[model samples]
Target: MIEKVKGILAGLAFRLIALLTLGQISPILSACVIIERDGKILLIDRSDGLGYTIPGGIVHYSETVEQCVLREAREETGYDVLLTGFVGVYSSLKRDPRFRAVALAYQGQIVGGTEHGSGEGSTCWQAPGDVFGHMAFDCESMLKDYLSEHQRFS
Candidate 1:
C-alpha cells in the first residue's frame, strides 16, 4: 500500500539524515495535539502496541509545528482540528527510545472530519483521569502538565 511505502521511505530518510549529521543533529522536532470533548480526550492506541498516546508525530521538513500537529491529528485520528493554544514543550534524553525528540504540545478542537482509527490502531475518547495509567511514551507527563495548566484557567 502507499501508506506502507511512505512509512518505509520516511524511516529510511530519517535514518539517512541522522547518519549524515554524524549524530550531532539536534533532537527531532515533533508536535502533538490535545483534543478534548465532553471532558474526554482523543487518544490513539498505537499500532505497535505501545499503549495509548495523543495523536502526533515528527514534523515534516516543509511544515511548521502548528501545521504538523494539525496534519498528524487528521492523519492519525481522522479529525480536522484547529489549534487553540499551546500547552507546553517537552524534551528529554530518554523520552523516546528511537532518539531524542522535542515535542510541542498544543490544545485543539475538532472542526471537521470524522473520528476513526488508521493503521495506527483504534481511536477513542477517554476521561482525562483514566488515561494516565494506560499511556505510553511521555504522554502521562505531557497530559499532567496540560491538565494542570488547563485547571488553572478553568
Candidate 2:
C-alpha cells in the first residue's frame, strides 16, 4: 500500500525529470547489504513474484552508498546492521528488468532490531546454499562471490 504509493510517486517524479532532460538519464545506482549470522544469510521475498533477494534499493540523491545499504536493510527487513565490509559492485545492464541498475553490494552484521516484512516482501534467514541458486536479480552471483571471498579468509 504505502510502498506502492511511494513507488508510483517516484516513477512519476523520474518521468517528469526524464522529460526535462529529454530522457538522457543513466542507469540507476543502488545498494544491497548481505547480512550474515550463524552461517545463514538474510533474504526478502519481493512480493512482486520476483522471488528472494538481498535487502536493498536505490540510493537516494542525498545519501551515500553506505547510508543507502543500511537504510534499505532496516526498511525492508526491520534490522539495524553495521557494515563489515564491501563485497563488490554489480553493473550488468540486464540485471534489472525495469531499468539498468548498478548495485553496490556490502557485507554486514545484524547488531539489533527484530525481523519483519515490508510492503515489498517477507523476510527470512536461509543458509547460503539454499539462497545461492534461488535468488532474484544478480544476487546469486553476488552471494557466491562474497561467500567464496569470505571462505578464503576463514
Candidate 3:
C-alpha cells in the first residue's frame, strides 16, 4: 500500500535527517495554507500515516515562503489557492517529530484547479471544530491560532 511505502520511506528520511544534522537544532523552513471553502477547511489524510496535516511542505531554496505556500498547496491538494491573510509562524521544537520545522502559515481561498490527492494524501474538507484530535504535527495548533484570529509564534 502507499501508506506502508510512506512509512518505510519516512523512517529512512527521519534517520537520515537526524544523522546529517548530528542532533543540532537545524530547523527547516516550510509553508502551509488553510484553504477555506464553504466554511470548511482543506486537510490532507497523509499517506505517511502521520494523520491529517494541512497542505504544506518544506520551502525550496529557490522560492520564497509565499511562493512555496502556493506551490505546496497546489501540489498536495490539487487546488490553486490565493493567499488571503497570514495565520502565523509556528516554530515549536515539537512541531514535527521527524525534524524541526518552522511553519509559515497563511489563509487562502480556492481560485482554480480540480480536487485530487498527491503522493502526500487524499484531500478532505472538514469544519474547524471537527478536526481537533485527528490532526498531525502542530497543525491543530496552527488551526486554533487561525480560528482565534490571532498571530502565534509557538
Candidate with best TM-score: 3
User: How good is model 3 by TM-score?
Assistant: 0.86
Question: How well does candidate 2 score on lDDT at residue 38?
Answer: 88
lDDT of 1 by residue, 1-154 (tens): 5444565576577668889989777778988988888889999977666788899989999999888999999999999999998888788777766556788888889999988888877899899888778897788777887788752111
Greater-TM-score candidate between 1 and 2: 1
Candidate order (lDDT)? 3, 2, 1
Query: What TM-score against the true fold does each predicted structure earn?
Result: 0.83, 0.82, 0.86
lDDT tens digits, residue span 69-94, model 2: 99999999999999998888788868
Backbone collision tally, model 3: 0
User: Candidate 3: minimum summed lDDT over ten consecutive residues — where?
Assistant: 3-12
RMSD of 2: 4.1
Quote the positional error of residue 152 for candidate 2 in Å.
15
All candidates' lDDT scores? 0.82, 0.83, 0.85
| Best-performing candidate as measured by lDDT | 3
Model 3 steric clash pairs? none
Residues forming the 10-long window of minimal summed lDDT in candidate 1: 145-154
In model 3, state the lDDT of residue 24: 61
Q: For model 1, state the Cα shift of residue 140 in Å.
A: 0.9
| Ten-residue stretch with the least lDDT total in model 2 | 145-154
